[model samples]
Target: MDLMQWYQKAMSSDAYLEYMKENKERTASILEKFSIPEEDRELLERIGEHSLKVIAITEDWCGDAMVNIPILLKLAEAANIEVKMILRDENLELMDQYLTNGTSRSIPIFIFIDEEGKERMVWGPRAPLVKKVVDDENAKLPPRDHEDFPLRKKEMIQRLGNLYSTDRTIWQEVYDSLKTSLVQSILM
Candidate 1:
């Protein structure tokens, strides 16, 4: 079945809300702070006449998704795009279609479908700038450090959380770039 059909199937069975309801922690708090900027509002306008459907694979417990999906939703909404979310665990086949590094099943992988139901663009797993921070931090670490690794994990999560919370512009740029690329591809 196509993604829209899958979205309908997930929605009718209440699976969609189940995931949203389970994500109450961050989603609730983020709603208050999340705002689509004027620049990004302009970016969305460039989408032109294309009808886009963003099908997201996410899970409630994902820290990255908690930070990213809401922003994407707001920007997409500004562009009159429709977004449907499905949990990663429940949609492994769909998740598999858009993996990280060709092997890892990553949450928050958004598969963009056109009005014809063809997959057009994909964005995901994490924001690119944030991923850069993570990559830089990981490169500095001992590859297999057994000592204090758990402590390091805690520190890293805290640092990444700080990265997302403080560096708000990156998310908007991410949306801008994503929308720009989609428009470029469509116009190409």
Candidate 2:
């Protein structure tokens, strides 16, 4: 099924609606905190003018998905950019192509593509910075209980902890970097 269908189906679920309602205030606060600046607002206009397509993979049951998806949707709305949401497990082929490290099925992977269908910027729950920390050679990381996916809950918690600990600085960096990248991609 297409992304719209997936989104409709997911929204139809009571659990999904409940999740959104429960986190509405927190989500709004985060969006307000991360408001794009005037300079970046022009970049957002460029992103909208380019009319790039954004494919987002997410699931309702996921906490990270719940948090990030709302932020993404709000960003798209503010920028007037088009977006499509899809469930990860429901679409294996697309997921396989974009899945990191050939295994992780993390959600809210935002895939940005230009008019000609060329990929430009991709961002979401798992950023490269976090991945590097998770895979550090010198660091002793916890093992995954499930053989299928190593570093599930443990890594997720660690990532969340790291995020909370350094949210202000890291979020600013990520926002600026992403804005610059998106602007450059569309302008180029």
Candidate 3:
């Protein structure tokens, strides 16, 4: 099915609702406080009638998804665009097609499909700063050091948690990038 079909199906799905409900804390963290700036709002408005579909391949329980998806959702709403989500586990074939680094099956992959279901762009995993923290922290760990893996992971988690908690400008950054990307995609 195309994105619109999937979107309609997902919206009324009890399973999907359960997923969202289960991740209420994560979702609330973003949805409760996030807002679009005037400039971002104007950019979204310009995308009016572009008939875009943001096919978000994600799992509700994913920490990254909870933080970033809501920000994209806000932009989609502003642009009057329909946002669709496909659970990664349930849609393995689709998810596999858009894997991170062609190996890691990362959650929260945002596939921008047009009215005809042609993918125009893809984004995922996390924002740049978050990715940096994850990469840098992981880099700090020594290879095959099982003894300290847990400790390193915990420390990385704490750093990531702090980053997400303190960062409000990430949303604006998302808006700016998406605006540039959308423009580029169409001009090709």
Which structure among the candidates has the greatest lDDT?
3
- Give one digit per residue, the lDDT tens place, for model 1 in 99-119: 799999877787778887888
Estimate, for each residue in 30-149, the C-alpha lDDT of model 2 and write its tens digit. 656765556566667767877776777766555455455555655677577666666677777667766766677766677776665567787766445544543462155445444634
The TM-score, computed over Cα atoms with residue i paired to residue i, of candidate 1 is 0.82
User: TM-score for each prediction?
Assistant: 0.82, 0.65, 0.83
lDDT of 3 by residue, 1-188 (tens): 65555555454223443558545565666766787777666767767567887778888767677667777777788888777778888888777878788999987888887777777788877767667757887888766558878887777766665565447766655556666677787543
Q: Which residue pairs come into collision in candidate 3?
A: none
Q: Name the runs in model 3 displaced over 4 angstroms.
A: 1-18, 21-23
Q: Local error of candidate 2 at 126, Å?
A: 2.8
C-alpha RMSD for every candidate: 3.0, 5.2, 2.8
Q: Candidate 3 — worst ten consecutive residues by lDDT sum? A: 8-17
TM-score of 3: 0.83
Output the worst ten-in-a-row residue range by lDDT, candidate 2: 5-14
**Deviation from native of the Cα of residue 13 in model 2, angstroms:** 14
- How high is the lDDT of residue 165 in model 3? 45
Q: What is the C-alpha lDDT of each candidate?
A: 0.69, 0.58, 0.70
The residue-level lDDT of candidate 1 at 153 comes to 75
